[model samples]
Target chain A: MVVIAHPAIAEDSMPRATLRAILGMRLQRWPGETPVKVFVLADETPEHATFSKSVLQVFPQQLRMAWDRQVFSGQGQYPEVIASTQEMLARVASTPGAIGYVKASEVTPNVRVLKIR
Target chain B: MCVCSRFAKTTASIALAGCLLSWHTASHALDLLDGDFQLHGFASLTLVSTTDNNLFGQSDNQISKDFSEVGVNASWRLTPALQLSGGLLSRRAGGTDDGGVRLDYGLLDWAPMSSEGGRAGIRMGRIKTAYGLYNTTRDVPFTRPSIILPQSIYFERTRNLTVSADGAEVYVERFGEGGTLSASFAYGQPQTDTEAAKVPLVGLDRPGKLDSKLAPDLQILYEGAGNSYRLAFTALRLDLKYQPGYRDILQAGRFRLTPLIFSAQYNAENWSLTSEYALRRTSISDFGPYFYNGTFNGQSYYVQGTYRLTPQWEALLRYDAFYADQNDRDGKDFAAATRLPGFTRFAKDWTVGLRFDVTPQFMLRAEAHFVDGTGFLAAQDNPNPQALRRYWDNFMLQASFRF
Candidate 1:
């Protein structure tokens, strides 16, 4: 899976910790203070699990638990769950400050691929 | 009493309907202000039955629907560094808690410092107390491992005093390759005026009032390997003063409680293991000769394991134990002195349960507990001491929904 972001974002690469914070729903804004809108596939999907495990280096359950703790406690919100990689691509391509993951083969020019160092 | 019951019945029906409806539809958080403002909520209903003693109402040999939880919360990120959030809850927990709309938490959180490494923040207002792992969101059914939390440390009788407090908290967190670390310190006034809070401490309503000084609570936690392992420690202290009532037999007195807790957990791909241990020191003074005036150390712990048979189904097993006074683990001396049952002061419980996620938004669970004592029974629910039983079994079923 490749991390995809809006084409408008300035940085083409990010630290893995910063990526984790973004997907963990902790980092609420980007460098320019653009509210970061996170998107993901349903937890039960293979793409979602692979992205969470191999890409983000966290378990899908961990992400779910974290989101539950934050959402229920009024600390944060859940990432918008997309139905498919096609939808994930479209959402990331259209939404400014949006971040998501899709299969490497499915990456399109409309979205920017973020390299995790 | 009649009014309360009617209200409970009404909400129960509505919550039941809500759960049923949720199974057929997919839901998400309601977003406004360009998704910066969000609203979310959950509702749950539980049915409980016991063998030999009343619990969460008169559930002896009959099912009682006296336990339920419903809540709604909203948060707005006024700016990246500032957020305003609040939650409203209506919880029904038998004789201990009436289903009344109450503010669960309302706070303003400010984080002026942030970086790739970590961030620091301060929260002010009525904030949820960070006790053990689960205290912060114990009311949310979807977050609990069982229908009822471990009674040993998370006692329902005095939950009002430990659930939330009005004050301020400062927190710092760090994110590194090794793991994530966070710590928080809070100074707040716990609610002590409720009957639920008083009955557990004084053993009766006593017609007097209980007031508490500002309490201090601290917790530090670390999550390693992406939450594959988690460890935490917590310390809390409360000091309370009691005023005698009209023609009261007791004199003005003071009470102090200090508790230290250790928690650890390991999460695997398909299974998880968790445990917590607590030491509590309590003392009462100036209450005159009739009441107990000395200090006693209490102990409680629990170990639990959960396995996911499939993504949609899970199973649980746990052993929980509590000793009101470690020195009197069996309560023999106290029983002889007060003429109460020896087993009333301690409890050991074994539990097993199953959960089925019918959908992401709806869940169903069933659990059974074999308890060896009535240590945590609410005095208000079982007013007569003689009616208490040493050995009992409890069964519970719950349906929960969230959006």
Candidate 2:
């Protein structure tokens, strides 16, 4: 869903915080590093681009391995897979501590848009 | 042992209660279970087969077979400051004896001091030995595709002692802007006899008579940006005092052995590389002049890369080489020897493979290895003058799951 970061971040900054947290930090500490967990946004939300960029920055190898393992083991449901940025923003706004990225034009008062470095 | 059993039972009972309460609440209310009772677990299954035309020069070389194994792991947060975790592994690769459940890891971690930026804790029980950068993280089957672990750093002899020490470890971690720094100190008597017999060699030798003295081990690790590193050192000293018939052996010997290991890894978008080197030295007092006393050095290096062609498919390539002073001496057949004296040589392998990530939790990997063997040990023992080839090849496919 639509992802948002603190307003302190610049609009043109890279959307890399989520990527850094998932790849650079170990899983045990991931929850403490960010204010929100990642989720899919409703298609109506404006913050789709930021969420897409965050996903793009993640190490593909780690993501593939983690998802493949989780899906095969039948332990739990996979994270909600979304196809559009508007949907991501919609979900992020409704969900607390929910973070995702959207296009700069979609930025609104409902959620804080963070700058990616 | 009784206390440990009671502790396990009590923990299980508590977990069951938490699960029941959560189920009732979820059925009647909108809230999920108390987030404090965190439940996490993972499971994996693998199948392997090998084909050989000539079994390492044996008369009957044609052999092929397939086998599978399953592993399950669970961890529970008993409280804000305490946690309990354990794993069970079962395999049918070798025979009936090889297909039994074993406790992979079981320990209680207590964080006496913890905050958003840092934590200090002590863990006790059957803790995994933190001897290298990978040891603590090696249990997750999905972390690597290969069925066989890197042999150079984690030798075959060391597996039996993979989990050791009825002791405690104190660890501290600090989070910085770029990454984290973590360090730990551990001391205690190893729980199993396996760690003791292999003393000088780590886990190189089969169990024999055991020396029941307390052994000490220490390790530290650091991770930053795209790199992770580790340094470890362990020492053991034994006095052979029991056998009166071998009084001379007692006087001829006090043994001290130490092994040092250093490793680093860098992960990138489509490739990851890891390398490690280790050195071991042994000294004995009172052994006769003919006793071969020298440092047995072994070194191994490997680099691996992966490319994602699509969301469901990927390719991998790797090369590894290992060399050890088999003779414990510099020169060829330098003869004078003591302790487990043998020859020295090197082995190398180059591998290429592909993996299909069919789903988030399942993957199938296929790889082929071309191996070259060298050194005095590669020479044939046969009196015949015919030359023997010093190379071989093998192929393997594995499918695994982690949850």
Candidate 3:
């Protein structure tokens, strides 16, 4: 899996924990005050499961519960869910401060690959 | 009196439904204000049955369905540095709650400092108290581990006092390479109008009401190992006064409660373990001979484990214990003096529960408990303390839905 970010993000790499925080909805903004939009495929998808375990190092269900608890409690919000990998790539590439992951072969020049620090 | 409260609850439910129905149209307009505006809600119904004692209704030898919860919340992110959020909640828990539409929280969050390293913010309004891991979302069943929270620390009898407070809070967060660290401090007036709050603070039949002054609540949390390990510490202090009524047996009283809690959890793919310990120092004074006006140190703790039987199924086991007075764990001295049952001052509970997620938006849960005391029982549900038994069994099932 390849982690991708919007073109405007200056840093090409971030700690694994930072990446998890963004996807977990704990960190909401980038350095420039741009809202960090997150995109992901359905939980049941193999690509999504693999990304959640390998990159985020968190269970798929745990992530879902975290989002549910935060959103319902008025403490935080949920990350935007993209239906498929194609949409994930397309949207992340277009939206500023957006971040997502996809198959290595699906990587396009529109988005920059983020290296795990 | 019972039928009257039930009728009022039904009317309130209808009113809540009406608000939700109208929000369907307003939901679209919310986006017009700002694309970031979001509206969310949830509802749940629970059935309870017990071998002895009434819980949430006439649960003794009968299934009681008076337990239900509903809530609606909205948030607008005006900017990265500022946001406005609020929610309304209605809870029906046997006779303890009246099922009225209550404002849960309405707050404005302002963040003046922000960077990749961390951020600092201040919130003013009705802010939810951060007492422990589950206090913030205790009313939301979908976020809870079981139908009922661990009564050891999150006692239902005094929920109004610890649920939420109206005032201001300041918070700071630091995002580090190792983990994330955050802390918050709040000073506010806790809600103390409910009978549930008055019963524990003074007496069950007190004609007067209980009022709370500005209290301070502080909490700090640290998450490490990519969010697998979590730790938290919380300190809460409350000061309350009693306003007497005509010919009331209880005189004007005052109370001070300071509780400190330590929480920890470790999460893995297939299973999780969590435990929390609390030390409570409570002092009551100024009441005449009608009540026990002394200071006592109480203790409570619980250990729980959850296993993922499958992707859609989960199982949980927990041991929760509570002692109203740590030094008087058996309550023998107090029982002999006050003529109350010794077992009433402490509780030992063993629970096993199961959860099934029918879909992302719906869930079903079942749990059973074998309790050895009446310490945590709601006083309103069991008005005649003399009829209480020392041992009891409780079983509950709940179905919840969320948007």
Alpha-carbon TM-score of each model against the true structure:
0.95, 0.64, 0.95
CA deviation > 4 Å runs, candidate 3: B1-5, B11-35
**Chain B TM, cand. 3:** 0.95
DockQ of candidate 3, scored on C-alphas against the true complex (2 decimals):
0.54
Question: Across residues B1-403, which tens digit of lDDT does each residue of candidate 2 receive?
Answer: 3345534533453354346446545764222233322233333334333232222122113332323445554454454456665555443332111334566556677766654456678887766666554454354555564544455555433344444455677778665545556677766555334322333231122223434355566666565642322223333222221111233322233445455666666656455566666564445444335334344654555665666677577777777666665443332443233222222245566778888877765678777766564221211121121232346565666776543
Query: Which number leads on DockQ?
Result: 1
Pairs that clash in candidate 3: B56-B94
Model 3 over residues B77-151: C-alpha lDDT tens digits? 777677788888888888788778888988888887877677788989999999988898889888888899999
Q: Distance from true position, residue B236, model 1, in Å?
A: 0.9
Question: Tens-digit lDDT track for model 3 on A28-111?
Answer: 788777877778888888998999888887778778877776666566766666788888888888888899999899899999
TM-score of chain A of each: 0.98, 0.49, 0.95
Q: Write the per-residue lDDT of candidate 1 for residues A1-117, one digit (tens) a residue.
A: 999999999889888877887888777778877778899999999998999999888899888988888777767777877888889899999999999998889899999999988
Error of 1 at B343 (Å): 1.1
Q: Candidate 2: misplaced stretches above 4 Å? A: A1-117, B1-69, B91-97, B163-165, B188-191, B194-207, B211-218, B226-257, B282-294, B326-331, B334-345, B374-390
Name the better of 1 and 3 by DockQ.
1
10 residues in a row with least lDDT, candidate 1 chain B: B20-29
Model 3 clash count equals: 1
DockQ comparisons of all candidates to the true complex = 0.63, 0.12, 0.54
